[model samples]
Target: DQQVKQNSPSLSVQEGRISILNCDYTNSMFDYFLWYKKYPAEGPTFLISISSIKDKNEDGRFTVFLNKSAKHLSLHIVPSQPGDSAVYFCAASVIFSSGSARQLTFGSGTQLTVLP
Candidate 1:
């Protein structure tokens, strides 16, 4: 019973192309969605986020789309660069600790290799 899953463990795309990562969630209570990017040794950093009320959110070269009815979400990076090579995690949570630490539920992760 996976509450969240990233079926594709990896994705490779040429530089200046587009990279798309997908995620699925089974919990209907999830209200917040987020994507984090990670390098080899560094901790995962927030890349983008979307609220349950919206269907799409974008920042610079990154975009995230949500399909609530399908319990699916995707992160899209346009003009993907060699620097974009890293792992991506899709996390979902509804119960954020009020005045406390944020607890995140992360997907397995999808390694994106942006080749030059």
Candidate 2:
């Protein structure tokens, strides 16, 4: 079963507009959330993270919001740019094992397009 899900498989937006991506989780025990941006050849989800301890986290043109009661989270990109176009992945944190690096469970991916 997919404990976490991104209901929308893709999203598209024009330049300078706001783009929103949504996700839902079935596991109430999951306390940490993240959003990762991926390009054609690189690895890493771009490492966007938010702790369940907080309701929201923001950085530059990106922001993430969480609702523990709803088991929902969303990522918003403002003034979407063509340069921002890429696949975005949603991941949740699992309990860490000793000496293990942080890992993520990725969504299939969402393709964001910023039309000029």
Number of the top lDDT candidate: 1
Clashes of each: 0, 1
Clashing pairs in model 1, backbone N/Cα/C closer than 3 A: none
TM-score of each: 0.93, 0.88
Model 2 poorest 10 in a row by lDDT = 95-104
Per-residue alpha-carbon lDDT of candidate 2 for residues 1-116, written as tens digits (9 for 90 to 100) = 88788877778899999999888888776677888888899875564789999999999989999988898899999988999888888888766566376556666668888899
Considering every candidate listed, which one attains the maximal TM-score?
Answer: 1
Per-residue CA lDDT of candidate 1, range 5-116, in tens?
A: 9999999999999999999999888888999999998999999999999999999999999999999999999999999999999999777658365567889999999999
TM-score (C-alpha) between model 1 and the true structure:
0.93
- Positional deviation of 51 in candidate 2, in angstroms? 0.4
Error of 2 at 63 (Å): 0.6
State the local distance difference test value for candidate 1.
Answer: 0.94
